[model samples]
Target: MFLYFLTLVLMVMGLYCLIAKKNIVKKIIGIVIMEYSINLFLILIGYKKDGIAPILLKNVSVEELTSRGVDPLPQALVLTSIVIGLGTLALMVAICLRIYEKYKTFDMSKINKLKG
Candidate 1:
């Protein structure tokens, strides 16, 4: 519902920042936003209305667990994605720091001096 549109808007905002921002750090942040938005979208896609945790209890029927419980796969996938995102963010920051060391600036335009 509203959440889908919100996630889509967030994705677009992230894309805009990534493409239009001139600061390297801002671009990195945009990448993170985009990643998060995608993760949120995935979680929403796997959502079940009136869903409960996918836990098995002795009193609960297998059919109830199957029909009423939320899918655990997406949650697991999101966890993995978060870890991967962290690694990616760290790599991006490390690269940014190296670039800053070279140009003494975080501005992408200013770093163009290295083109020569």
Candidate 2:
């Protein structure tokens, strides 16, 4: 219950940062935070109370392996997600830098040229 609450809190905080912040850099940070929170939640979902590593030995039977090993799918998924997040963060930061170069400011409010 407590973990769920914490997850919700993290998600809400990220959303608040993304929505309320005026700086483009801060918005990118918020997006990164949101991605991390989602990855954490996904990893937590696959965790077992008392589980062993999912290494396979020659003598280990299939049933024993299934009973004692931790789930590997979530770890793999999280790794892929982290890679994707890194790519996205890099793109966002590049765009923010370009924006800063053009406007010489980080505040989005100052970038009012598109308003019509």
Candidate 3:
């Protein structure tokens, strides 16, 4: 649907940022964007029309719960992915800071240490 297309567009924008940008920070932002788009896509997949929460109540049977509630697996997976992304973002920023301290600039072409 339209949501899926939007998600795809976000993902493409992320990839373009990653490929087209020279700054390490911009690449990190692109990675974060891609991660978010994927999480959004998973969340949308788990959505249901008129769906109840996944929590179980005493009155609800397994069959009724399965039929009435949205899937929890995708939600759980997205949460985990978010945590992982946070850690990754932290590491990336730390690396960028170190690189900036050493190189004094964020531009990819200006750093010549890799030429060896």
Candidate 4:
């Protein structure tokens, strides 16, 4: 509903930041924003109204669990994605730092112009 719309908007914003910004740091931030929005979208997909944890209980029937339980797959997938995203972010930052060490600037345009 509204959440889905917001997620889409957030994704667009992230894309705009990534494409329109010239600062390497800003681009990194944009990548993080996009990653967060994607994670949010995945979480939203697994959401259910009045849903209970996806767990098996002795008293709960299989049909009831199937009907009422929130999906666990999306949650698991999001968790894995988050870990991967973090690793990528770290790698990006490391590369950015190395670039800064070499060029003494975070501006991508300057870096391009100064390349020798």
Alpha-carbon local distance difference test for all models: 0.94, 0.88, 0.93, 0.94
TM values, all candidates: 0.91, 0.89, 0.89, 0.91
Error of 2 at 37 (Å): 0.6
Q: List the lowest-lDDT window of 10 residues for candidate 1.
A: 107-116
Residue pairs in clash, model 4:
none
Could you give the C-alpha RMSD of every candidate to the true structure, in order shown?
1.6, 1.7, 1.7, 2.0
lDDT for each residue of candidate 2 in 24-107, tens digit (9 for 90 to 100): 888888888888889988888888767777888888777877998889999999999999999998899888889999999999
TM-score of 3: 0.89
User: The CA-based lDDT of model 2 is what?
Assistant: 0.88
Judge candidate 2 at residue 33 and give its lDDT. Answer: 83
Clashing pairs in 1: none
In model 4, how many backbone clashes occur?
0
lDDT of 4 by residue, 1-116 (tens): 99999998999999999999999999999999999999999999999999989889898889989999999999999999999999999999999999999999998888765345
User: Candidate 3 residues 1-116, lDDT tens each?
Assistant: 99999999999999999989999899999999999999999999999988888888998888878898999899999999999999999999999999999999999878777664
Per-model clash counts, in order, read 0, 0, 0, 0
Off by over 4 Å in 3: 58-64
